[model samples]
Target: MFIKSFRPFAQSLRAPAAIILVATLAGCSTFSGFFGGSAKKPQPAELQPVVALVPARQVWSARIGEVTFPLQGNISGETLVVASNDGTVAALDTRTGRDRWRTSIGAPIAAGVGSDGKVAAVVTRANEVVALDNGREIWRQKLAAQAFTSPFVAGGRVFVLAADRSVNAFDGQTGKKLWAQQRPSEPLVLRQGGVMLAVGDTLVVGLAGRLTGLNPLNGSIRWEAPIASPRGVNDVERLVDLVGHVGRNGNTVCARAFQANIGCVDAQRGALLWTKPANAAQGVDSDERYVFGAEADGRVLALRRADGEPVWSTDLLRYRSLTSPLVVGRSIAIGDSAGLIHLLSREDGSPLNRLTTDGTSIAASPLLAGSTLIAVTRAGGVYGFAPE
Candidate 1:
C-alpha cells in the first residue's frame, strides 16, 4: 500500500469511508537494496542508530483489514486506534494484534490522529467531526467548511481546526460544537496551552517572528517580543505548515518556520522567547532541552533548550525529507527516506543500529509510549522497538 498516498490530501479533505489493504511487497527490494553492491559502504550518517535484534524484535505483525489513508496511530485501553485513507476507523488489540471491531462512517478518509482515549477524524463528504470509540461513532457534527488538522483531542474537549480557519470545540462524547472561533489565516496546528492558529479574525492566534503569546479562548493578542525570523529561504512559496508543538518545557509553545527555522514563544503571553535557525520545510520536534531537525543543507542539528544554540549536528539526507527524530531516553530515533529507522546516542551523535520497514517515509514520526519505541512508515507500517 505504499507506492504513493492512496488518496490526495489537498485543501479541505472530504472522506468517504474507503478501505484498502495493500499486499504489495515488490518494493521490499528497496530495503534489501540490489540498488548498489553490498561492499559495506560506510556512507555514514552523523550518527548511527542501533537496535537490538533478537526474536524479541518481531513482537507480532498483523494483516489488518482494508485500511486506506495516510496512517495515524493512537493507544486507547488495550486497543490501538488506526485511521485509514479509506473512510474507516478500526480498533485492534494492542497486545495480540487482533481485531476488536470495525466501524465505517462515510467521510473523506483523513490522516486524522487519536488523542486521549479517543480518535479524532472527519467524515469524507460531510466535513463533519466524528468521534470514534473502539470502532464505533460516538457522535458526528456537521461543519460549515471542510475539516483538517486531524481532530485534536485536548483537555477532554475535541478541538478541530478547519481548512476554512475555524476552531471548533466539540463535546468529546457526542460530536457537538460546544464553542467555535473563526480567524483569518488557517488554523493549521494545535498545542496544549498555546495559541490556536496562524491567521484569521476570531481565532487568528499564535505569535511568531516578533510577536509572542496568545489567548486560546478568543484568539486575542496578549504580548509581544523581538524574535528574528529564522534566516533562510522559503522554497515552497507561501506554503507554511503551522504545526505548533508544546515543548515538554511547560508553558512554551514552539512553532517552526517552514523552510526557515524554529520559534519558541511564551505560551501564555505570545511573547517571543527565542528564534533559532532550523530551515525545516515540514516541521520539527524537541524535548525542552534541545530541538532537532534539518538545517539548510539537510544536516540535523541539536540545539540547547534554554537558548537556541548548536550542541550537535549531522547529515540527515541528500535532498531533504520530513521525518523528525523521535527523542527517546538516551537515544534519538530518526527515520530516513529509505524506510530505515536509526538510533543515535544522545550524548555524542553516534550510530547505534538500524531497522528495516516496508515502505518509505512521507509522514513518519517516532512513537514513544512507556518503554516501547514506535515508528510508522508513510505507506502504513508500524514498528515497535525497544529503546536500548
Candidate 2:
C-alpha cells in the first residue's frame, strides 16, 4: 500500500470514473490511486551508463522493517529511527547501519517516528499517538482522527496532523495534551505523505494548499500564507494538497502544492516571497544557495533560493519516478522506482554516479548523515553510501 504518485491533470480530467473509483477505495484501504484498480504498473526505466566523475560506493545496508506506505525516518544525533506498518520501531546507528534497539508496540502504525533525541512519537492505525523513550513505551494518547503525516517533535512538543485536518500538539515528555488547531478538511487528499515544517518557534503546516504558521507553544495562528489557490469546476481539478517534505533554512520556508506550484514564504512574517509554476508531485530540498525538486515528468531541477529563479533542470531521468532530491556534498542525490540512487552534479544537474538499493522502489528522500547518504526503500531496506 505504499503510494508514490504523480498523476497528470489532463489524464485525471479524462477519467472521472477513475476518480470516483479511487474515492470509493480510499475509505476502505486508507490508500487510493486516481487511475483505478485496472491501471497498469509502470516499468522501471532502464539505466544507461554514465561517466562516474566522482567515486561513490555503498558503505552498508540492512533490512530494518517493512514500510507499507511512503514513510519518513528521523535522525536524532547519530541514531536513525524508523517505523513499519506492522508496529515495529527500531533505532539504528546512522554510521554503521547497526541496530541500537528495536520494539513492536503490537498495533498497526499509521505515521511517524518523530524524535528529538530523548522521545520518539508515532501514530497508530487504532487512532492513537504513542510515545516511546529508550525503546520503551512512555505514554499513549487517543486521537479523534487518523494521522496521515509524521508527527513532528520540536521544543519539547510533539505535533501531528490528523486526517480530519486538525493539528494537535502533545508534551514531548509526558504526552500531555497541549493545544489543538482545526481547519476545514478537504474532501479528497493524498493518503500518504503531507507537509509539516518547524521553523524558528513556529509550526508551519500545509493544509489544503495553504501554509499556516502556528505558535507551537499555544497553537495560535501566527500567520497564514496561501501556497496554491484551488481552481476549475470539479473537485478533482481542485485537488492541491501540499505533498511531501517542506524545506526550511533560516526564515525561508518552501513547499510544493501537488499538481500546482512550488513557493516560498517568510517564516517570521508568513509573507509570500516568490513562487514558480511547478508541476511537481513531491516537494523541494534546499542547501545554502539552491532549492531542488523533481517534476511529475521525472525532471530534476534546481532553483535559486533567493528569487525562485530556475538555475538548471535535467530530463535525463524522465518518466523514471524520481524521489525528492537530497543535496550531498558536491552532488545531488535522488532515488527512483527502480531502487537506483542517481547522484547528479549540483552545478549543472549532470549525472555523476549511480548506486542501487534493495531493488525495491525508494519512496522517501535520501537523508544525509555526516558524509554518508542514507536512502530507504519501499520494502524497508536502508542503504548508506559515501563518496569514495
Candidate 3:
C-alpha cells in the first residue's frame, strides 16, 4: 500500500521536471525513505530491556490538542510555552505542570508558541502573525507568505521567517510592521521549522543553507555564513534548509543543514567555524564540550564542540524515528516515535535510562526547564520528568 502511494512520487523525481513547492511535500519524514536511497521502509529495531542507570520519574503530564504541525516549545525560565495545530496555545509551569495561561487564535496555527515570558507569538495558517499578552490577543499582522518556523519573540519584537524566504519584524506590543527583508526564493524548502534566534543584538536566521545575521533594529544584513550549499541533481536532492533547535554556547551557535551538514558559527563574528557532512533531518543540541544529534536512520552521534569531529555514535535506536536530542546534566535525553524517551550518557552514547509517555510520536524536540525535562507527544500529551 505504501509503495503504491509513493510510486508516482518516485517516478516524478526521476523525470527532469520542476518539482512541486515545499508546501506540497508531506513532511521531513515523507522524504526519508526516498531521500535515504531506499524505497522500502526499514523495520525499527526491537528495543532491549534497559536497567535504569540514572534515577528519574514522571513528575506530571498535561494535554492541549493533538499536535500535528512542526511544533517547537518555548522555554522561558520555569514556564514552557507550547501550541497545538488546532491553534490552542498554553504556557505550563515546568515545575508543577500548571497552566499559567491558555488561549486559542481561532484559526489553525501553522507554527508557533514563541515566547519571551511577557509576550507570546504564533503564526496562523491564514498567513497572520498573532501576538498574545498573558494569553489575551493583543494584535495580529498579515504575512506575505506561509511560515513554518515559529515567530521568534525576543528583545521586545516578534520576527517571522516566512517560507517565501523573507524575514519580517514587528513591534511586539503594537503589531506594527517594523522592517522586512527578502532573499531569493529557493526551488524547494523543508516543511519543518527553520532556525531563527537572537545572539546579543543580532538576529541570526537560516536563509536557505546559510545562517544570516541581521540587525534587529533595522533589517540589515550583518553577516552571512553558509553551512551547506546546493549540490544535487534535482530540487528534492538539493534541499538544504536549516532546521531549528540549534545549539548555542556563549557566542558560538551550531546548527544542522537539512540532510546536508552540521556546523558551528561564531555568531558574534558571523564566521563559519566548520561544517561536516550529516544526513539528519532534525536539529542539534550542545553542552560545553559536545554537540549531539540523531541521523535519519536513528543513530545518535556526538561531535566535538571546537571541531566537527565524531566523538561517539550509537545505533541502539536504529530505524526508529527520533527527535532532536537535549543535553541534560550528564545525560542526553531524546524521544522516539514510540513515545519512549531515552537518556544516554553524554560521555559516550551509552544508554543511561529510558522513560515513556503516551504511546505516540514525540511532536517536538525534548525541552529542559530548570531541572525538569519536558516531552510533548503527537497525541498532545505533555510529560515532565525530573531526576528522582
Best by lDDT: 3
Residue 195 of candidate 1: its Cα lDDT? Answer: 26
Off by over 4 Å in 3: 1-38
lDDT-superior candidate, 2 or 3: 3
Model 3 deviation from native, Cα RMSD in Å: 9.4
Candidate 1, 210: how far from true, in Å?
A: 9.4
Worst 10 residues of 1 by lDDT: 8-17
lDDT of 1 by residue, 123-222 (tens): 4445667777656678877777654345655444566665445567776776656776555442222111112432211222333333333333433445
Residue-by-residue lDDT tens digits, candidate 3, 1-388: 2112111000000000011235532342223224335478899989898888998999999999988778888888788889898889999998988999998889999888688888999999899999999999999999877888888887778889998889999988999999999998765676778888877777889999999999888899999999999987976777778887788888888999887899999988999999999987888888888999998789999999999899999999998888888888899988888989999999999998999999898888888887888999889999999999
Instruction: Compute each candidate's TM-score over C-alphas.
Output: 0.70, 0.89, 0.91
Question: What TM-score does candidate 2 get on C-alpha atoms?
Answer: 0.89
Candidate 2 lDDT (Cα, 0 to 1): 0.76
The clash number for model 3 is: 0
Poorest 10 consecutive residues by lDDT, candidate 3? 8-17
lDDT winner, 1 or 3: 3
